[model samples]
Target: MHSSSVSGSRPCLHSFKTTLPLKALAFSTMMLPLHSINASKATYQFDTVVNQNRLIVVSVENPTTVFDKTTHLHGFGYDLVRSYANSLNVKLEFRTVKDNASALNMVKSGKANFAMTTASFQAIEDKHLAGFSATCDDSSVLEDNGLNVNLNWVFKHANDPLSQNASAYICNTKQNGTISQLASFYNRNVVKDESWDIIQRDLTNRMPIYKASFQSTAETYDIDWHLLAAIGYQESYLKPNSVSPTGVRGLMMLTHNTAKAMGVNDRTDPSQSIEGGAKYYDLMLNRYSNISYPDRNWYALVAYNMGPGAVSQIQSRLKAQGKNPNSWINLYSYLERHKASNSRYGQATQYVTRIRAYLEHIKSTPQLVNL
Candidate 1:
């Protein structure tokens, strides 16, 4: 339950408990109750958690919660819970679970301090565990398939300090419009172009053929395979023979020039194209070497579609406006303006947006469950 109890080992960036399903890497730890004095909060009985060190949270992946998973924790619920953890100056130890029920059970059983909940103000038939639902659920698709998402942090005891503080944090953020800003900020990502039926069909019919290529290519670049798969799906719906008018083709829709540059000889070969795309994507990452990841990943992805020159232009524009150039949320309104004025931003934004949407499905696939 506590860090000291985990064989004196510190969990790396990615870890989880997968009692019910496909995959995870983990060590057992949980959040402990509050100490009698502020100075004593760091101590624990079973050593579930210490205020000065770790705050463990459990969640099922959904857009409203964690849309991504263990490799990199991300999502709206992840953001909210991370903020709360930051307030306490503790490291957040995110634990992924198979369902809402597993998450609740973890909290009740003291394996985590709290659980992040993403329930429909309407119900969703299919579900998966991304970190908070973590990274992938932020957007619906390029189209408007938005839904009202209600997320909450569930605690074991209503009177516990972790619970009370989380409740207070939510209330304070809501009162200050921080929560609203986050919701509005993420509104652009709620796109669902593929119906659940289509997603299932593709999962069954198409995914197995290219899974190894996705896994190998992504691992070479230290990228999540699901994220790479998302980009591929957006490019050609995972069709090995598909081609665009501009001549981008194959599983990854690689242009002839980009493919050649990345050492790919066959544009129609799935493995070659996937490898080429990963290389090109890695090249985009190098273009913004100064920025940190997740943000770097976002920028590189946009650059993959819009060209590094366009991303540079956006950075310059944002800097001129005194905004953070490295952040994707800042690009949203700027891209919207370009779409309004000249319709130039649609393809680039669509490129990133669809990747975002497809990632949720790729991560949520019932059979494969690529975390």
Candidate 2:
């Protein structure tokens, strides 16, 4: 259970008008893990989180909703909850679990204050969980009895004081368009649109072919398997034999020089290409160990695409403009602006954003997790 306090009064940041990287880092520092809290068992109740020094949230990690393994909590849910926690002046902690069942169980067991998960109404009724409809993200659950219920997170009790605050936060943010801005800033693409439809179609049809290779690469390099897969999708749309005009080939679209460097004997072979990509990406990650998790991951992705020299130049540009060199948004904005002058750089920018959108979709949707 990693926890941190955010002090000082500052307006919650908007997309383009966001505060500096220092401030963003300050607010985004809250996060979680799960364990028995017998010591605080007596004090553990849903409302106690507000009264105590911390706001404990239990959730599963996904690119958009959560970053479970990172040193800091980020993504969409973190932003929303950070606002609510700061308003109450409590340190926030997100207790991450392996699945929705674990998240709900923690909240029900009083090990957590609130849960962000989805369930059929019958499951909610059976577990006696309180789902806040306002917080729904257009997801649904199919009941064991074959009924569909809107996806939702639940409170411990119907009348828990936390419910009122949570509901207010959702409605207020929705009315102010903060939710939309946050979505745009995080995902950087329209959710479930034509492009999304294509991705989904590919996910169902194309992803299964390459899933095991990615998983194997993940175990070897200790990277998120989905992230590598997402990169592959962005590169060649998951075509195993894809070839760029410049001769970068295969699922990962590795250039011949890069493939040889990574010891990939055949760039057109899925296993060899994916292994080469993973090895190359691992090399980039090693260079970025000085940075933090999640940020380091993003920076490494940029390095992998545009080369570390390019990343250094971009960092120099950001610093010259008084921006944080380590800030992804700053880097993203710089890339967005310079893309007109350099189409390659712009593609690199889109590369990351599209990967992000794909990751969010894959992680948020339960059906896509295993596939």
Candidate 3:
């Protein structure tokens, strides 16, 4: 027997004529090879091959307050990278390093798809790694006084257009997203009778403001001015003579232990205090990297006030309440609920509330720029 090709271009089957018993003929038909037939059917069924999308790994230095803010408040670079990956139908991964050098190496070795840190390209050679469209503004608080340190995004190369473009887009997106989230959160919690405008007015009226400086020095540590001011407002209202009941002293209010950890011998010196405070906050932020933003920030504040261990206990309580353990609001509410009954909780609440109020005041009054 022979079978004709459907298109008549080629023979589909071949057969040989032979004298055979009906039983033999049935056996031959049954034993005919089916592998070729299955292969042909499969070829027709799947005419094209689809390639898997490549995965991107974004790396960062040990999580700092800035990274916390970006991740928690702005969804770190995750939101942006995720959106891009979704569009391309790819996957995004994150890797973190203990320091800047390691983070750079990750990108250079192609172990990471990109590096996201408060890195300055001018500080390093640009040939090995590429930065995205985002420039991170590093915020720091003074040691003796809470002051703001603002640092701009740093990239690996000065001439890379891709890095520049990525930096611009990221900055804009972060700014818009942060503003929106802050506003929404504020509106939800703010009392109807408490005017944000009045809060702004009071903050603006506060005096003894620190001078803004962007320069790096042994004394100043080259922190961003605004960040320092924000810290100052939070810690002690930028009052150089301010002293916490716990003996944290100076404008940035450096505890003896905290100052010692940051290698500050002169806790009373404004410059030393600021540097120590900034470094300490950086350390605290790095310690809580897994906490995610808004929560990261919340936890950092809690750690700053009640200590990390106490915050952990509060987090457990928050988890029990079906609230996000990392949210500032939930933490704040929990602190309030526990303050009356729990001595440790009461102390933590007092500290956290003060910081929250100061942060809110700073956010509302841009005119307090002098501070």
Q: Total clashing residue pairs per candidate?
A: 29, 2, 41
Model 2 residue runs over 4 Å out of place are 1-73, 77-92, 96-183, 364-368
Global lDDT for candidate 3? 0.47
Q: What is the full ranking by TM-score, best candidate first?
A: 1, 2, 3
Whole-model lDDT values for every prediction: 0.61, 0.65, 0.47
Candidate number with greatest lDDT: 2
Q: So what's the TM-score on candidate 2?
A: 0.58
Error of 3 at 307 (Å): 1.5
**True-vs-predicted CA distance for residue 194, candidate 2, Å:** 2.6
RMSD of 1: 11.3
For model 3, residues 260-308, the per-residue Cα lDDT tens digits are: 8888888767666767777766666677888654456556756866667
Which candidate number would show the highest TM-score if scored against the true structure? 1
**Candidates 1 and 2, the one with greater lDDT:** 2
Model 2, 267-292: lDDT tens digits are 99999999999999999989888875
TM-score per candidate: 0.64, 0.58, 0.42
